[model samples]
Structures are given as structure tokens and as C-alpha cells.
Target: MTGPIWLQWFYVLFWIALISLMAIGGYFMFRKFLKALPKADGKSILDWQEYYIKETLHLWTDEHKALLNDLVSPVPELFRDVAKQTIAGKIGELVVKEEAKQLSQDHIIRGYILATPKRDHKFLIKKLKERNIDISPYQELLK
Candidate 1:
């Protein structure tokens, strides 16, 4: 109340800018921290995901790739690639576990369902239905 109007505005703007920068820095640091953290299996989560995806990259047909792109279409553009990679990695893990010779539509659908969180199951169901993929087989997983 004692200072000039301009000085008061400058003080408020300075604090706002400082807080914003701190928040941005904190976000980056948190991401770096997560990337370094090891998972229960000894490898960092990102490393495992990359390994699974690379292991089965040769098996993914054009159709399978297209289907994954379609499934991730609803995600925002900024995060779409990460979403695709995560889902693809999960699918690859499934294929490896089963020692399957080739990827199938069933594998893709099941992987998508499992990769997504439970809170998003409704969206998953709607998306799968839109593609005309049966959800009956995954009813238990969804719950």
C-alpha cells in the first residue's frame, strides 16, 4: 500500500515467474528420476519396454501397426507416441510369453486392454467396439 503501483505489480509478477520456473524444473527432474529408477525385474522400466518392443518388431505386420495407430488415435498428439510404444511393448511381451509365431488381432486387443489403466476401461471398451472387436473374452480383465 505504501509502494508505487508499478512496484507492487512488479513484485507480484516476479513471484509468479519464479514459481512457474520452479514447477517446470521440478517436472523435468521428476522425469529424470523415474527414468533412472529400477523396476522389480532389475532393469529400468523404460529399458524393459524397449527390449520387448525391439524383440518383436520383426513380427509386426503392417495391419498390426495400423491397428495400434488407430487404437492410440484418441490420445493427445504430444503423448501419442509414448502411448503407442507402451501398448506395443505390452503386446510384444505377451507374444514373447506365449512363444507365438505371429502377432494376431486378438493379441493386439488384449494388449491394449491390459496396457491401459482400469479407470480408462470404459474408453477402451468403446474404442474396441467401434473397431468391431469382441470384448467378451476380456470381460474378466476389464473388471
Candidate 2:
């Protein structure tokens, strides 16, 4: 309150700039930390996902891939790629588990549901219903 008008504005701007920089720096640091942390069976989450995807790449038919894209369409463009990859990774895991000959609609639906956060189940349910896909088989997962 005792400072000149210019000094007061400068103080405000300086704090704003400092906080912005700190937030940006923290975000990058957190991303690096996540990438370093080990997940499933000592593999980092990224590595685990990559392994599943690579192992099942041959099984992802064009139709199955398109369905996956449709399932994640509700996600914002900014996060769609990550969402798609995560869902695909989950789907890949399911395919491997079942020893499936090829990707199926059921596998796609189950994987999308499993990979999505619980809070977003409503959106998923709506998407499935819109596509005329039966939700009865996956009721347990929606809950």
C-alpha cells in the first residue's frame, strides 16, 4: 500500500509470473515421475501398455481399430490420443488373455470400460447404446 502505482502493478505481475512458472515446472516434473514409477510386475506403466499393444498389433483388424476410435470420440481432442492408447492397451491385454484369434467387438467394449475412469461410465454407456451394442453383458463393469 505504501509503494508507487507502478511498483504495485509490478509486484502483482511478478507473483503471477512466478506462480505460472512453478505450476508448469511441477507439471513436467510430475510427468517424469510417473514415467519412472514401476507398475505391473516391475514394468513402468508405459512399458506395460507398450508391451500389450505390440504383442497384439497383429490382431487389431481395421474394423476393431475404427470401433476403438469411435469409443474414445467423446474424449476431448487434447486427450484423445492418450485415451485411445490406454484403451487399446487394455484391449490388447484382453485379447492376449483370451487367446483370441482376432479382436472382437466384445473385447473392444470391455477394454474401453476397463480403461476408463469410473466417473466417466455414463459417457461410455451412452456411446455403447448409441452404437446399439448390448450393455447387459458388461453390467458388472459399469458399476
Candidate 3:
């Protein structure tokens, strides 16, 4: 009759297995849910378009978003931040140009190029300078 203890042990083992499976499944589902949810903070390139709203889109909103989306992926997000007064007007000229500048990876800042990329870094600096961002000292590095 004490052999019935084996059955109890079996039941306990089965319960432990089931509980573990449920917990693992729940955790994975939660992770997927978080991925699918919109990241309105714009912390990543994938979060930008999701956060962009009709009201926030200004002056060729679709176009700006289309171009802005290019900085990331088919689903763009970003960590960029700006003065939150009126994002509409500021988004296009101010943000767009600055975003383009940032995308080049040249790190153009105040008439100087600090850190440069490996390949095409010169081209990026040249492009920024052509846009009048002023990347001069780094050009000397080329020499």
C-alpha cells in the first residue's frame, strides 16, 4: 500500500512540469505582446512611426514620415527628442534635416568632425559640409 506514494510523487512531478510550461509560455507571450505594442516614446527607430500621429504630422506629413521612416526600417523608430512645443512645423525642416544629418554617421558638430565611420566616412562628411554643416578639420585627416 505504501507503493501508492509513487503515484503521489508522479502526480507532483506532473504538476511541476505543467506549471513550468505554463510559466514559460506566459513569459514568451508577454514578450511578444510588448513587442507588438506601440512605443510612443520614440526610443528606437521602430518606435517612431508607431508614435507619429495625424495631429503631430505637419506640412507634408506623409512625406516627412516617409523620409523619416527611411532612417530606420520599413517600420521606423528613433530615440530623437526635441522641444515638445509644436512638433508639426519643427518636424519637417528642423527635425528632418537634423535627422538626415544624423543618419550620415559622420557626427558632424559645430564645423568639426569628431568621430568618423570606417568606410564612406569622408563622403558623409563631404555631404554634410555640402549641406553647410561645416566639416573642415576632419578633411585635413584625409590629407
Candidate 4:
């Protein structure tokens, strides 16, 4: 009692369809898993910037480090917090004075320098000056 030829063919086709569907589903699932995984290199923009700043600081001469320390030291208590904002503004002023352009013209570098601790404002200004950034316009801010 063999099955009808047509029935046998139907069974074969049905199994083929099921297995094909399973393979397709598995492929899609694997793709989704890969998409969920983090990038292989794993370094982000912030991580790169932090590395750059650390390397830059590490290469500074002792004189440069001392100058930076002097620049960032805390102001009087009354101006401590406000000083950061003031220094950031002073940076913008310096950029405009030297380049004849707004700080927004080089927002990334401006933002990076401005993100430093308030005490390091002078350090950032000095680094800019070393690059021929001309901080004379903002010198009054350091007073």
C-alpha cells in the first residue's frame, strides 16, 4: 500500500517548503543579531577626543603645564562658577579678534576647549595662543 504518486509529491513539496522557510527565518534572525552587536572597533567620537586631549596634555613641556595651571586656577569665590562662562565667552572673543570670524566658525574646537574645567580656561587660552591664536583681545578677562 504505497501512497498515491500525487500524495508523495505533495509531502515532498511540503517538507521542502517548511525547511526553506526555516532556513530563511534563521538567516533573518542571524542578521538581526549582527545588527544588535556593537561596532568592532568600538571607539566613539567622545572617546577619540578624550584620547587626543590626553595625548596633547602629555606632550606639553613643564613650562607649558605650569602656565596652564596658572591659567585655570580658581578665581575668587564670588566669580568661581561664572568664570567658566566668562572664559568661554573670552575664547569666542579671542577667535573673533584673531581670525575675524565667529567662534561658531570653528565650533568643534571651541566647544572642546570650552568643555575643560573652569580652572583650565587659561590653559586652553594659552594653548590657543601657542598656536598663534592671539588671545590679546581677551587678556582683560584673565584679570
| Winner by TM-score | 2
Instruction: Give the alpha-carbon lDDT of every model.
Output: 0.88, 0.89, 0.41, 0.51
Highest lDDT: give the candidate number. 2
Q: Which pairs clash (backbone N, Cα, C closer than 3 Å) in model 4?
A: 72-119
Residues 56-106, candidate 4: write the lDDT tens digits: 333345654344344445456665444434434444444444653322324
Task: Determine which window of 10 residues in candidate 2 has minimal summed lDDT.
Answer: 32-41
Worst-scoring 10-residue span by lDDT in model 3: 107-116
Ranking by lDDT: 2, 1, 4, 3
Q: What is the lDDT of residue 133 in candidate 2?
A: 85
Candidate 4 RMSD to the correct structure: 19.9
For residues 1-143, what per-residue lDDT tens digits would candidate 1 score against the true structure? 57899999999999999999999999978986897699888898678789999999999999999988888888889878988988998999999999999999988988988898887678778888898888999898888
Per-residue CA lDDT of candidate 3, range 6-110, in tens? 899999999999999999999978865775565566353224423433323443435444333332221112322321212222342333545442222232121
Taking all chains together, the TM-score of candidate 2 against the true structure is 0.81
